[model samples]
Target chain A: MRFAGRVAVSLYLLVVSLGLAVGQRSLEVCSGCEFTSLHAAVQQAAPGDRILVRGGVYREGRLLVDKPLSLLGENWPVLDGGGEVEILTITADDVQVRGFVFQNSGVSHIEDLAALKADNVSGCVVEGNRFSNNFFAIYLAGSEHCSVRNNEVTGAATSEAFSGNAIHLWNSSSIRVEGNHLSGHRDGIYLEFVQDSSVTDNISEDHLRYGLHFMFSSGNEFRRNTFQRSGAGVAVMYSKETVMVNNRFADNWGSAAYGLLLKEINDSTVADNTFFRNTVAIYSDGSNRIEVTGNEFLRNGHAVRLLATSMSMHFTHNTFTGNTFDVTTTTSRSYNDFAENYWDNYRGFDLDRDNIGDVPYRPVRLFSMTVENYPQTMILLRSPLEQFLDYAERLLPVFTPRAIEDDRPVIGKP
Target chain B: MNEAVKVMKYGFFDLLRSRWIFVYTVFFLLITGGLLTFGGDPNQAVLSALNLVLLVIPLVSLMLGLSYYYYTRDFVELILTQPVSRPAVFLGHYAGIALPLALSFLIGTGLPFAVYRAGNETDAPVVFSLLLAGLLVNLVFSALAFWIGLANEERVRALVIALGVWLGLTMVYDGLLMGFIVLMQSYPIERSLIALSLLNPIDLSRIVVLLQLDIAALLGYTGAVFQRFIGTAWGVAMSLSSLVVWIVLPLLLALRTFRRKDF
Candidate 1:
């Protein structure tokens, strides 16, 4: 009797495994389908089911995915907004939407409506979708473990006031935004009150405002992205424990444009980035506990501008070349630590052959210091005699920011 | 003088007659007005509008110049058969196309500013300078288009080459400059600034105008350097000289090339 029971149990297990393998069904929803709408098909879809939408202009209202289902579009299917509301709304777990074009979202300054809205969802994937002329492209609010990748968001941002972001995340955590092209929006990507999110390998250009703007967001890692010809490259504010690495911030030239602006941030790591030809490479205000390393600052208007309140940041292993100003500080009492940086303006000797300077290199210039004291001193920056004065001042540091010195300066470019 | 005025008048009327040009002008006006009304700060709004106008006007001017030259290849041929010099014809056609377009640009760009009253009083000079700079840009591109049209007998080839030149100037030149700077970082060759600044027309314009804004501090370290070298009256003189060089040298080269060509 025991042998018979064991054999029966084995047979039951085999049957269950087979059922699990073949139980997942695929539902085909075409333009000529009886349901005729993506929302209708989604409402009818069961757990572990697939809804394949064929090529057609589907004037679907906001598609609320409230079930564990896959909604796939074939041949570049378009979801028209019909001038009413958002295109897709995801409120369920384990949802996937791919390969569709979402367009024509209603403009609203009060509400942050997006072409694709992912809210309170976990393990969701949104990929290979094209969003054009939308108020906001992809918005994640209070969502977790979500991935938005390989999407194109193009906006006709006439003004910063009327237009919204291409991709915006608020109060969301553990989100990944990767491999996307975002252009011509107020901001290409914006993060607010978010934590533990990562944005990587995205190209954001031609925006009216910042290419990437993050406020009160912490524990986020931004890497391998390119911000070109935007109003500003990126703005990180009021956050802690973040990492920015290996990004190219270039050609973002304007009156107030900066490659990166760090404001009130603490305990962040910024490394291995290239800031090329921007108005300002890095502008820091009241930021602290940050480690900046292995970055190249090239041909920017100002490489680094540290404000009075900035404190406790470690800047090392960075190369500052061809910038208008290598370093500028408003006050002499900054707690920031500068060491092991390769300043193009460094004129100290390296007699020891250890790639370290024999004497401490003061990154601040006397002219810059004068500007700090009296703003009008900048009027003499390019005068023929000013060069002699600068050389004299560099030979013997005077009136420069007191605390603005780089110890252990590198002989070679970092 | 009368003939030149007549030529200008005819060119204006001819542009007005083209449906595509009218349509494009209308489209530009609508878009520029809409953007200025809705976008962020008044300064940024004006800047953005100017940027669009600068980018689009050149392309339009290039295309119009190219097509005008192509369609009126016979007219040019007839004028050449007469007692008129090729240079006069070239200059006449250039001034004719440029003046009207400049006026239209002023109208299209200026009308929005009047309607919105968005920008500050300080912004007026920059705005005016921006418009004038854009007109210069139009002239530069139109001359380039004319040169291309003259150099290449085939209309398609001329159009293609003109577009290529535009792309090279606007995008590829910057990319190359970045690459060069990265490659040559070790040397104290910051002296190359003078030569490099002269090569690109856009940089010349930016340096000259940006210096006038007196916001050099906002521009990273390079702005300080620029302020040092080129921030004063002498710097402005240098910038103006470079601009003149950019304008005249290219035209001279084009003229020589055109005169020598078998076509």
Candidate 2:
């Protein structure tokens, strides 16, 4: 009697396993279909179901998902918020939101609103979406193991009083944000308390404030990002162990603007970056132990302005060309190490043909020091008298700090 | 007066024969035209062209001064010994040299930029400012050259002195001014720098044109002092008058020296 009971239990287990394999369902949500909106589709969906929302202007104001499902849209189905609230809100884990258009999140003074808001959920995916004229297009709050990819976020904010960030990440870990085109926002992408995340292949431009503003974020990486023409300035502040690679910073010109601003950040490696046409390319303050290598600074007002507090920076194999001033510092320049850089202002020759200039290249112009002290004396720039003074300063250095010399300035562009 | 015009007409034709006029005209044509054709935007073209104007205008003006005085010594001596009086000969010669230089500059820049402009309104003002600034610099330098040439006895000495003044004003004066600022970094230098810029015609012309080109706006500094420097009508009037002074003062000094000096 015991042997017969075991055989029956084994047969029951086999039947249940077969049912689980064939239980995955794909439900359609269209204007004419049974499940008309994403809300109705989510209500009927079980775990691991795929909800396909078809193309149309869906005035579905706010949607909530409680179960694990893939919410896919075909042909960018419009999710209009009606200027009142967020269009989509995800509350469950393992959720996917893709190929949708988000527009018109209401201006809020109290709450931090977003078009696609993900809260406290893990393994959420937001990708291939277009965002326009919205406040905080992709807001990831306390979410982990998520990815936001290939999204177009654009808006012109008249003022910072009511504007919001394009991608605002808060208290999130292991998020991957890549291939996004962002412009005209208060900030293109902002991160606070985010760790172990990577942002790559983003083109951010024309912001009233900053291209990328990160604060208190640690252990993050930025690669292949282009930031251009941001007005207020771009800053990386209070961060640790960050890596910035192959990024381009261009054309941020203002009295207070800089291409890349580093404040109180430590243990970072900024490599293969290009900075062009900024009033000040890199303004670093209180940042220590940063390795800046293989970068190009071209046609800027001041290539690098190292404020008084920075220390222990290593700049190697960088090219400085056509900048008004290569390196300007308020205090003496012993805080950093420079090596093997190429400067257009370098008037040295190599006798032995080693491709290394025989004389050390001095990068600081005395006029830059004057400008730093006065800021109003910039009218003397490019004057023949200033050029002569710069020539004289190189021979017998007086006003320029002595420690800002590149001993191994290469003869040719690196 | 008719005799003055006759001398002026003859002097104009004589200057037209010289190679300097063609080269001057061609240089302006190529630079302005090249910038317009390739420099992406009209504002950028103007900015690039300003550097050329500041450097080239003074150098060429000095060269023309030395050549006009030394190479044409025989002609001037012949005209002076004729029925022509001092004013007609001297003033007619001055007009002959100045008018051609100014006209060539105008045609060289004007033709190219007009061809490339496509009737854009904003571009016209920028080009106009550049043309006006070039003319101002040219006239000032030409006048200075005339004075230097008139003061010295030896032709070689006068030529050397004129070139020296060009170098000193363009290079050494600026150097000394820069060194002074560096040495006195503690004191206020803004008002002084503005005052110092007024002392050099090239510097003054540069600032006037650069202000019109909106370089301050390009650099994103909308400061009150910068705006007040060239923003108000009073500021405009002041700079224009200063430019006129640069033109008139040197010419008057040349006339005084020429009237008394023996050939």
Candidate 3:
């Protein structure tokens, strides 16, 4: 009697497995097919099914996926929002959306309309998509372990009021955003309340506000990203343990612009970055324990504007060349440390042949202070009087922050 | 105009043969050529050239104009006995010295760029501005020197005053402006700063170069005020017209002094 019962249970398990394998079907959505629209195909597809969408425009208002499925596009099928609603929203787990062109989502201030939005979903993958003129390109909210990669998104943003970000993440964790080209938006990439996420190999340029913005986001890593010519450049605020490595910030020139603005940030690592021709390379206000190492600051107006409120900031192994002012501070006293840096204006010699200068190199100039307090004095840049004041101040330590000197300055590029 | 041209030709030829003018030309050549080769960047060469134009050109032009007056006094008195009008001799002598100096500057700086093919479309505007600044500075300082020579009877005194003028403009004026801005830090002094920069020809030339080299830097803080005024075409026209006025006022003053003075 026990052997017969075991055989019946095994047969029942095999029949159920066979039923699942046979029930999952691949559906095609095209002009000639019965499933003419993407919404119709998604509506009819069961859980764990695959839907292949061909190259045709589907003017669907909003296609919501409540079950796990893979929506694959052959030759980039168009998902048009008809300038009225959000195009695609995923509410289920383990859903994949790939190779679709999302276009012209409505610009409504009341609704957070997005070309593609993944909400309350886990293990969601959005890849190889192109988004243009959307209110928000790809938005992930309350999602975890999702990846948005290999996407090109551009917006027709003229101002910050009406435009949205290219890729925005809110309350998401462990999300991987990689290989995305984002431009002409309010913010290229924005993160709020996001943790343990990685943003890598992205080019963010010409945005209305910031190339990349971090608000209340902690434990995020941004690597190998190029942020250039944006309104105020990349701003990392109210975040901790954020690692920004090997990034390039260039040509963010304006009255209030900075290459990287770090406000109220703590315990962050900004390493191996290149800041070129920015009005102000790194502006740190109320930030602490920031380790800025192995960075190249070239021809910037002010290489680092370290405010008095920032503390315990370490600057080492950095190269500062051709900058108007290597360091400028708001207060005459410095709490940050600068050591073993290479300065183009260093006139000290290494008499001991140790590849380190015997004398300290003072990066701050007296004219820089005067110009900081009284910006109108900027007209005196490179003048003989300014040079004389700097020379005199170097001889007699006064006015400038005397503690902001690189005692072990590298003799050459390090 | 013909008489002025004749007198100008004589002076121009005389200066071209002088060892001092040759040294000046060679000095510029060495500076530009050395910077181009050693600095390995044309933009850097232009910046160094800007400093040379600002510091050296005004002083050299002043000394040349004043000393020429003192050394050539007998010749001037002899020329006065001729049928030439005073304005002709004065304008001719001014152009004569100014042209050779301008040419020397142009050749010394421009030859390296032409040889290197370094003046791309981006660099062309900066180069043109540098040359213009040099020429205007030369003319303005030379006119002031001539006026000083005509006003002061003693050569040593005239030379001393000319040096004082250079010192005052290049060094002391900026120092005072710095002090003033610091004192008036509470108020909005951006427009006043621009007006003050226009008051000094050296500062004006410096602004022209600053607009190019440190423009990224200048677009921030008080520098933004300068960029807004100096970066626009209208601002450019205003500064340029102001520079032209600098040349005209000094030359007009010197010409008036030359016309009424009894040799």
Candidate 4:
């Protein structure tokens, strides 16, 4: 009786597998095939069906997939939008788009015209796609559990007035934007009202505006990303509980540029990042309770420009070398805390061999204070007089911010 | 012109062989080379060289010009006894001393950079600007030294004056300028600060180079004012002309004294 029951269960499982195999079909869409157009192929394709698109230009105006399907491009099939319409729009969950070149989407002011867009979709995967000169490259609106991986998005945007973001996420959560190379957009990756996303291993360069701009986005973690030569660099505003780690911000130098601008950001942690040659490595305004630790700041203008409005901010275990000013502040009273950070300008000694300087190091120079008050006094930069003033100010706490000293400054690279 | 060139040639040959010039050149080479090897970035190497150049080059050129003028007084007198005009003798001796000093600075700081292939197209301009600033500093300070030499009869007094001028320009003048600016902080002193900073050649050269090195730092409010003034083509032209004037005025004054002074 037991052997008979086991045989019946095995037969039932086999029958169910056969039914699924019969239901799910693989369709080929090529120039010589019956379904030449991707729009028709996606229409005919049922849920859980896989459509293989061959190497050919599919000038389908708009290919909207309303059902769950997998579209795999064999030889990087071109989905040319002809500069008049959106290329691929996914409306259903569990849709996967892989190995396609989406190009020349229509430019619009009222609507975002993306090469590939997902609306209210979940568990969608956009992988190994190349996007060129689209108004918006890969856009996700109200999407959850979506992943945009290993995509290359390049635009020739000149001005911010007409350009859109390369990868834009709106009201999306649990999204992963990883291993993407983006350039020449207004912003490389833009997150507005997004939450619980992870942006990792992305190289964003030469954008007209911010490289990674997110506002009202919370609990998003960014790691191992590089942002360079953008107009305003990376800006995190009106956000809380954001964590950025192992990222590099480089060469973002201009009148309005900053390596990282934390505006009204709270309870965030910035760790193990590198900032090089930026105008201002980190500019904090009205930020509170942020921990910046284990970072490297090299050759920047102002390593950290902390405003008086920032409260309870901690800077620790960071190495700052070759920067013009290690720290500059707007007020003489500092509410921020800087401890155990290695500053190259620190002149104190470590007689105890504890690797911490016995004498507290002051990062705010007198000249910086003077320049703060008198903006025209920047002409006196690197002057011996200013150097002397700063040296003297170090000896005596006169005009510099006394509260801005690092009590236990590190001796060498941390 | 012929007499001046001849005099310059004699002075140039004499100073070029001196140990001071060799040491100056070697000093630059070692610093620049060391920075390139260990500093990692060529532009950063140039930046380190800039501080040393700004501080040392002016003092070296000033002292070198003054002492050369003082020690070579007998030779200059002998030259003056020739058919050469006083202005020619003065100008030629000035060129002779200035050229060698400038050459030493160029070879010292420039050789290591060339070997390293230091800067790309973007960084090349910065390096070039730094070198230019050093050259201008050399010219301006030496001219001030020559004027002091002609004005003071006693070598000791001339040396003291030369040292004083160097100190004032390099250190004290900016202090005074700061004091002035602070006193007038309530007023709109961007234009005035520009005018006042132009008065000191060291401050002027420092500002010009600072504009290039710390432009990002300078793009803030006051820095923006300077960027507008010295960072623009017009501002650069203005500062360049001002530097030229700083070089010319001292020499012209010395020229007048050289023509009229007794042996």
Model 3 off-target regions past 4 Å?
Answer: A1-24, B40-44, B71-88, B114-124, B215-219, B223-227
Candidate 3: fnat, from 0 to 1? 0.61
How closely does chain A match the true chain A in each prediction, as TM-score? 0.91, 0.93, 0.94, 0.95
Stretches > 4 Å off in candidate 1 = A1-23, A373-380, B1-263
Tens-place lDDT per residue, model 1, A1-414, is 999999999999998787578776677777687667887788777887888988889887778888888889899889999756888888889889899999998788788888989888888899999999999889988899999999999999898887889999989999999999999999999999998989999999999989999999989999999988887667878999999999999988776688899999889899999998787788899898888998998767678889888888889889987665788888877788888889876778988799999888887776666556544334334322234457888767666766878878889765
Q: Itemize residue pairs with steric clashes in candidate 3.
A: none
lDDT values of the candidates? Answer: 0.77, 0.82, 0.88, 0.88
Task: Give the Cα error of residue B218 in candidate 4, in Å.
Answer: 2.9
- Candidates' chain B TM-scores in the order shown: 0.85, 0.91, 0.95, 0.94
Docking class of 1: incorrect
Pairs with steric clashes in candidate 2: A385-B174, A385-B175
Please give, for residues A331-414, the per-residue lDDT of candidate 2 as tens digits. Answer: 865779899988877899999999999998878787677667756556666566556667787778888877878998999876
For candidate 4, chain B by itself scores a TM value of 0.94
TM-scores, each model vs. reference = 0.62, 0.79, 0.92, 0.91
Better of 2 and 3 by TM-score: 3
Tell me the lDDT of model 1 at A145. 91
Q: C-alpha displacement of A136 in model 3, angstroms?
A: 1.6
lDDT of 1 by residue, B1-263 (tens): 55546556767688778776667667667876887766533454554555554457668878888898787667656666777655666666667776666667777777776667644575677666666666666677767777778788888888888888766665565555545545665554344755675677665555555564434535333445545565457867777677777667667777786556554
Worst 10 residues of 1 chain A by lDDT: A376-385
Model 4: DockQ vs. true structure: 0.50
